[model samples]
Target: MPITPVKSTKLYHLIVEQLKQLIQSGEYRPGDKLPPERELAQRLRVSRAPVREALVALELLDVVEGRVGDGWFVKRAPDSSLDVSSVEGRPPSDILQARVLVECAIAEQVAAHHDDELVVGLHQAVEAFADELRRGQLNGEADRSFHLLLARASGNAVFADLVAYLWDLQNGQFFRLVEGMTGNERPRLERYVREHRAVYEAVETGDAGRARDAMRIHLEGVAKDLLDS
Candidate 1:
C-alpha cells in the first residue's frame, strides 16, 4: 500500500526534523552534497513539493545551500555557543545600542527589497503575536519571527544569519527581563504586540521611511522600559 499524503505543514516539518537528525548524526556532514531529488523523494516517501519547501526552509536557517546545477549541500553546523549568561550585569545601554544598529540596518534593507512574500510572512507573524498576547502568553517567539522575517526580506543572507545569532544570544535575557518587568503590569504585554504590528504595517505598506521609523521607535521604547524598571 502507498503512503497517505502528508499535510503541507506537517510534511515540511517532518522533512526538517529528519534532515536535522541526519545532520546531527553526521550522515549529512557539512559540505556533503545531498542526494538528488528523486533519491530523497523515494527515501522520505514524500512528493518533491514538500521536500523543496523543506529545503527552502533549511536554506533560510543557513543549514544548506543549493548550487546551480550540482545539488543541495550542507552548509554549517548550528552554533550552540551563544553565551547569554555573560550579558547579565552588562550595561543595558550597550545592549540597546547594539539592537538599534542591527534593527535599523534590517529595516533599511527590507525597505530596499520590498518582497511581497516577506511582507506577507511579517503580517502573519504580527497576527500570531497578537493572538499570543490575547491568550496571556509571552510573545517572544513571534517577536523573534518578525525580526527573522525582516532579515530574510533584506535579501542579504549574511544579515539574516547574523540576526538569528543575535537573537539566540539575547533571547534568554529578554525573557528574564519580561518576567521581571511584568510583575506589576500584565497589561503592558498588549503594548508589545501593538508595537510589533506597527512595524509590520509600515513594512507591508512599502513605506521604507515609515518602516525604519517604526522599528526605531519600538526599540527605543524597549530601551526606555528596561532603564525605567
Candidate 2:
C-alpha cells in the first residue's frame, strides 16, 4: 500500500507556500500567465479550493491580476524609477488631500462622541511610540500604531480601519523614503512629534475644529518637506 500522506497542515496554507516559492524563484515571471486553476490543482495534487485561496492571497499583494475572462496573470514588476524619498514617496500634495478628506471627517465624528476609554488608549499608544522613537527604533509598526490609536479615538471604526489599511499598504515605501533623508533633515522628526502632540491636545480639550486644523497644518508641513527635497 502507498504510505499515507501527512495530513498535518491546512491545504490552503500549503498551496500558498508552494505558490509563493514558485513566484519567488521566477518560475512564474512577472506578466506570465498562471496555469488554469484546474491545471494547477491537478499538478499540485490539491483541490481547487486551496488553489483558489492561494490565488486570492497573491492578488492582495498585487502580485497577480485576475482578468474577467482570461486566467490570472502575473502583475508587472513595480516601477523602480518611482521616487520614494521620505519627503517624496508620498507627494506632500497627495498626502494633504488625503488627510483633509479622511482625517477631517474623522475629527468631526470624534467630536460628536467622546469616549474616555478610547482617549486613554490613544495616550498609551502615543507613549509607546515616544519610547520607540527615543530608542531609535522608529519602525513602521510603531508609527502606524500611533496613528491608528488616534483614528480609533475619533469614535469612528470605519475611519480607523480605512486609515490602518492605507498605512499598512504604504508604510514600507514610506519608511524607505524617510530613510534616504540626510541628518540635517532630522528636525522633521521633532516636528512630527510636536505636531502629534498638538492634535492630542486639541482632542483633550474637546475642540473638534482645532483638532482638524492641527491635523491639516501637520500634513501641510509634511507636504512642504516632500516638495522641498
Candidate 3:
C-alpha cells in the first residue's frame, strides 16, 4: 500500500477534520450528541482548547448544534443537501448590521435592568478592553469580551452565545481581508476604545436611551468603515 503524507496545520483544524470524518462515516448521526469537550480532549490526548475550537467550526458548518446548558450534538450529516456554510459566508457588512440590531437592543436591556453586580462585571470588561488597547494588542479578544459581557448583562444567554458565534465567524480570513483593505487601523482601534467606554458609561448610569444610541452609533460606524473602505 502507498503511504499518504500529512500536511502541517493547526491542531484545531486537525481536530475538525477528524470530527468531520466521523460525521461523514455515519459514526455520528444527526441529532446524536457528541462526547463532552473534556472527554473528547482526553480521548484524543490533546488540550481542550482545540476540541472547543473544532466544535465551534463544526457548528459554523451546521454539522453540529450547541444548545445552551446541554452538550453539543450532530445537527446534520456532511452530505446533506443544505449549504449552511454558504449562509455563514454572508458579507461582513451584513453580519455587522445584524450585530448592530442585536447588540443595540442588548445595550438597552442592560441599561434598563442593570444591578450593582452586573455593573461591576461591565466595569471589569471595560477595564480589560482598555488594558488590551494600551498594550497595542490587535487580537480583538478583549474587544469581543467587552461586547459579550454586555450581552450577558442583558440577562440572556442566547444573546451572549449569538455574539460569540458572530465573533467566531470573523476568523483569520476576515481580519486578513480587513487589514489588506484598511490603512487607518490604529485610529480605528482608538475610536473603538472611546466608543466602548461611552457605551459602558451610558449603561452604568442607567440611561437606557443613551446606552442604545451609543451602541447603535458605534456599530453603524463600524458598518460604514467596513463597507466604504
Candidate 4:
C-alpha cells in the first residue's frame, strides 16, 4: 500500500485510499508521521493541492491530524466505514484558486467602470463584514456579500451567478473543515476586513489595476494562511 502516482482526476480520494490502505495494512501505526506534502505530491506526480485536500479530509474524519508547524501524523487507523469520497465537491484551495481568477477579473471590471450606486453597495458590504468582526464573530455570509456585489457591479449576470455558485461551495462542507483555521482569531479576521476595504477603496476610486491586485493579494493571503505552512 505504498503511495504511488495516481492518474485519476479525483486525486483527493486516491490519496485518501492510499493512506487508508497503508494504515490498514499496518504500514503506518497510530502516531506515525506521514510524508511531507511536497514529497507525497512528487511521488504521486500531482500538485500539492489534492494532497493537502485529502490530508485535511482525513483530519476531519479522525484518521489523521495536522500540527500547525510540525506537519501531519496518523491519528488512528482507518475504520471500515471511513469514506473520503464522501467529501463534497472540489477542494477548498481549488475553489479559492478559481475565485482568484474570476473574482480578480470581477474586481478589475468593477473598478474600470465605477458607478455611484455600486460603490455605495460595496461600501455597505465592507461595513457589514466589519460589523460582524466588531461583534467578535466570523461571519462568512457578510464576507460573501462583498464579492457577490462586486461581480454584479460588473453588469455581467454570468459573472455574478458564477461567483454565487462558487460562493455556495465556498460555504459548504469542503471549505468548513479549514474555515476556523483561517478566521478564528481577532487579528486575522481584522486583516481580512482591511483587505476587503482595500478592494472597495480601489473600486471606489476607479483604479482597475489596484482593484485586481488587492483582490489577488487577499485571496493569496487566504491560501497562504489557510493552506500553506
Candidate 5:
C-alpha cells in the first residue's frame, strides 16, 4: 500500500469532523436544529468563518440540512469519518492532475459559449497579470486569478467553485513549495504571463480547439516542472 503523508488539520475541517461526531454520537439527532453560528463559534472557541465553512461543507456531505431563515439541522449521521485532511495536505502533483482534467475541459466550454461578462472578466484577468508581472510583485495570485477567470467563463458554478478551491490549495501549498525551491521569481513570472496571454487570446478568438490545446499544453508544462523540481 502507498503511504499517505501526514497532514495538518484545517480549522474548518476540524469543525466539520467535530460536528459530525456530535451528530453520529446522538448528541444531535436527525431533525435537531443546530445552534446559531455565533453559538457554535463560541462553543468551539473558533471564529465564525470556520463554523460557516463547516456548515457549508456538511450540507454538501448531506449530513446537515439548512432551511432558509430557520437554521441548520442534522439531516443524517455519517457512516464513516469525513476526513478532509488530504485536502489540506494535497501534493502539487495531485493539484496539477486535477487542473489538467478540469481546466482543460473548461477552456473548451468558455470558447463555445461567448458571454460579454466572461470576455470582460478574462481581459481583466490578463490585464491584472500583466500589471502585476511588470511591477515585480507578481506571485501565484496573478496566475491563479487568470485561470479562475477562465473557469468562471465556463458558466458552470460548480466548476468555477472547484477551480477556485484548487487555486487556493495550489497557492497555499504547492506554489510556496515551488518558491522555496526556486527562490528567484522573475523567470517564472515572465513565463506565466506569456502562457496566460496565449490562453486568453485563444478564448478571445472563439477558437475552442486552440483554447483547449493551449490550456492543456500550459498545464502539462506546469505539471512537468513541478514534478521534475
Candidate 6:
C-alpha cells in the first residue's frame, strides 16, 4: 500500500515494515501487547537499538503506546494516513555515534586553546543546564547552549555550526522520543549532570586528550543508559 512504503536504509524502518505486516496480519491486534524487546530483537536477528527505535517510532505515530514497566501495545490499526514511513529521523543511537566523533574533537580542540572567558562560559553553561535539569526539563535552552559553547570554544565557526546541526537533529521530534522515554528516572538525571561536569573539569584543566576521553565516555554512557543497555 501507498507506493510500496517509503524506501530507506534505516534498520528501524525495516523493522517498522515487519511490524506493520504483523499488525495487518492480525498477529498483533489492537489492544494486544507485543513481544518484549529482547524477544523482538531475537526474532529480527538484530540488537536492541533498532528494535527500541522502531518501537519509539511506532509510539510517535500513535500506532502503539508504552506503559511504564510494560512493553509496547498496539493502539490502532495503520491507516493509509499512517505508514511505516511516518517515523523519520536518525535514531538516538546514531546521533550519539556521530557525536562521539565530532564533539570529542571539539572538546579536544577547545581544551588546548580556551581563554578565561571560555572557561567562565563553560562553567555558566554547566550550571544553566543543571538548573533546567533540576526543573525536569531535558531539552532546555541551557542544555543546547552548553554543547554549542563547547564547539564555539574551539574558535572555529564551522565547528559551532556543525554542533548546532547535530543538536538540531538531537532535538528532532523522532530523536527526542528516545529521551522522553527515559522519563523521570532520577539516576539518569543525576548521572547526566555528573558527566557534563566531568567534561567541563577536563577542559578546565587544559588536558586536550583527557577532555576528549571524557566526552567519549559521557556520550557512550548516555547511549548505554538511554538506548543500548
In lDDT terms, which candidate is top?
4
TM-score of each: 0.59, 0.60, 0.66, 0.58, 0.70, 0.57
- Candidate 2 to truth, TM: 0.60
lDDT of each: 0.77, 0.69, 0.83, 0.84, 0.81, 0.81
Backbone clash count for every predicted candidate, in the order shown: 0, 4, 0, 0, 0, 0
Off by over 4 Å in 3: 1-88, 171-173, 181-183
User: Candidate 3: worst 10 consecutive residues by lDDT?
Assistant: 80-89
lDDT by residue (tens digit), candidate 5, 97-201: 899899999998898786767888888888888888787765567778788778877878889888887777766665455667556657766777788788888
Model 5: residues with Cα > 4 Å off, grouped in runs: 1-17, 24-27, 33-86
For candidate 3, give the lDDT of residue 211.
98
Candidate 4 structure quality by residue, lDDT tens digits, 120-158: 988998999999878866757788888888899999999
Q: For candidate 5, what is the lDDT? A: 0.81
Residue 151 in candidate 5 has what lDDT? 86
- Poorest lDDT segment (10 consecutive residues) of candidate 1: 78-87
Q: For model 3, how does the per-residue alpha-carbon lDDT over 43-146 read when each residue is reduced to its tens digit? A: 99999998999999889888899888899999988774433343456778778877988899999999998788989988888888778878877777888889
Which tens-of-lDDT digit does each residue in 1-229 have in candidate 1?
Answer: 2243666447888898788778978888998999987789889999998899888988988989988788999997644434354345456677777778888878966876678888888889888878877787774677788788888888888888777866665554555666666665455657777888887777777777887888898888878887786
Which clashing pairs does model 4 show?
none
Can you give the lDDT of residue 127 in candidate 3? 84
**Across residues 189-225, which tens digit of lDDT does each residue of candidate 2 receive?**
6677777777777777778888788878877786677
